[model samples]
Target chain A: MTAPNGMRTMLGRVRGLGSAKSGFAHWWAQRMTALALVPLVLWFVISIISLVGADHAAVSAWAGQPVCGALLIALVIAVFHHAQLGLSVVIEDYVHEEAPKIVALVLVRGLAGLLGLIGVVSVLKLMVGS
Target chain B: MDARKRPLSPHLQIYRWQITNSLSILHRMTGVALSVGTLLLLYWLAAAATGPAAFATAQAVIGSWIGRLLLFGWSIALFYHLCNGLRHLAWDAGYGFSLPSVTKSGMAVLGATAVLTLAAWIAGLVI
Candidate 1:
């Protein structure tokens, strides 16, 4: 249903794009994670700076704090999710072959998610004081 | 896909170098770098959680000259990505689209990255 001005109807244009549909979800997720990361990343940088030259016990004790551990877990999730979304775009743009693109996308998502989980688990372990 | 050879759309090779273009590319580059740097962050966290011995090993490696060099690069990449991501957010909010404003903001992002990275390193050294 293209119009006289050579523009297809809104629904017509996005008819069969699969999961992404209109891409609003992906765009929003990226922006939301970026927004969350702004504060988390700042806290992380400050924490790391404060911990410089800190002994193992001191660093471990710091991480064992509930506030620190909670924030770190949040940082890990947000950062990895944001990175996964960003990398997916790069792969889609550069890897034109369908099979390779799918493989790369899966690998990126899987690894990012796995690392994110490990990061959270590490923080949780510290919080438990073990 | 088309089977016949046809003139392709203009790409990077056709455009003159500009701050905006450079910043756009640099943003992606830094993003990739930061993604890779996440492994180091994960290692530090895992080591800290594991035990004093593991933590000590992480500290020793990270304190080495080569490790510091890599950390320096990671620091710059982190700052650059953060600054440029904010710029993208501003664009999403429909600001800084004018040519002059775009160029100015690109320069601002670069300046902020340098200043923030420097400040971070100096603070790290002091503390």
Candidate 2:
């Protein structure tokens, strides 16, 4: 069978010698997350700055607001996701050893996921009170 | 795969330093630093969620001289990464590929980072 336009040849696809076929997805996701983070991070920095020197009660009250909690959660997810994607590239570029590279990738992904979860939970707790 | 001596591509040691190269490397460096800095953010959030005591502990750590210094560094890194990241995005979008344009954009990124970091710190301290 003939390969379709812009498609890999059947034999080439089967061999899989060159492309992973998923690099674009990773690249696109990184860019999308970066775009989302521009505003989210700006908002977070400004919010924290405004809350500088504020008491615990005030900070809690501010975080507890629905809008604030939602945005904070969004920020956390975007930050961790973007960070994971970025770090993965760095590891792949620097770590040439096959086994260690896999281990590092797994560790980075795990840490990113765990930290993102903790951030979400924290925001939720603050929203719920105490 | 057999372990064999092979001619590898030229790398950093061979190239002369330039703004483009410097900014590109700095971008990665800041990215790594920001990755580590996420821990501080996580700590603050967890502490805030825990209780007044925990939050106070976090505040004390973050308010200390060392903590402030780290924060200052992270802020600079963050702004630098953010601005250069936008420059990268512009390049990805097929803009600013010419040599002069690239250099100009690199300079602009540095300027933007400085202004943003300064503005953020000022706002943080003043407001």
Candidate 3:
């Protein structure tokens, strides 16, 4: 139904603020990423700190394990994804040149994806002994 | 390009530096640093996955003077971002809106970041 002289809905009152406009989707995404970071970051920092004195072989071996490898890959992805999202907002808000903003966005997406994929593949090879 | 009207000539150059302003600017600064740090993390992951030889190269870089410097900066960035992010989280929850609290938290976060960075470095050295 619709809200009108002859209809049976209240679209008139809701016209400005209802489904006509976007919801807090950006805010939600930010919060979701932030929440994911909470635990992932804690684990990552611990891992990094714990591995500080480790040698090349030890690090390789540790990261070679399936569980550790998978977690590192997850860390890489989450990091890049979060970074991309954060940079996009900054560029969108502050970059005065549209061309530069678009360039930055594309670069961030491509570079982050490439780096994250490389990290994941590296982990897989290490774990699988490839 | 679209042109917009401006009100006056007053700008950031005209203002005196203050704590709140510094925090605001440093928040963005740390965000950018963290973005770069993300690439380094990705590099570490990729190197780890490649194998012993590749991992060795990555290790050498990470152990190099330049790499150590970058890593040190990245560590500072990590801590700064974490502390500042916590402040943001608090604000999101409708807390710390008062000027005094904001400045206080800003200083606290800065201090926390410094302490954490130093602690991490000391731990790294011990390792």
Give every candidate's TM-score on chain A.
Answer: 0.84, 0.86, 0.76
| Docking class of predicted structure 3 | medium
Ranking by lDDT: 2, 1, 3
Report the C-alpha displacement of residue B111, candidate 3, in angstroms.
1.0
TM-score ranking, high to low: 2, 1, 3
Clashes of each: 0, 0, 4
Using lDDT, give the best candidate's number: 2
* DockQ of the two-chain complex in candidate 1: 0.80
Kindly list the per-residue Cα lDDT of model 3 for residues A63-107, writing each as its tens digit.
877787777777777777777778777887898898998998899
Question: Cα deviation of A25 in candidate 2 (Å)?
Answer: 0.9
- TM-scores for every candidate against the unseen true structure: 0.89, 0.90, 0.84
lDDT of each: 0.92, 0.92, 0.78
Extract clashing residue pairs from model 3: A53-B127, A119-B46, A122-B49, A123-B49
- The two-chain DockQ for each candidate, comma-separated, is 0.80, 0.81, 0.62
* CA error at residue B123 for candidate 3, angstroms: 0.8
Worst 10 residues of 2 chain A by lDDT: A1-10
Ranking by DockQ: 2, 1, 3
List runs of model 2 lying over 4 Å from the truth: A1-20, B1-8
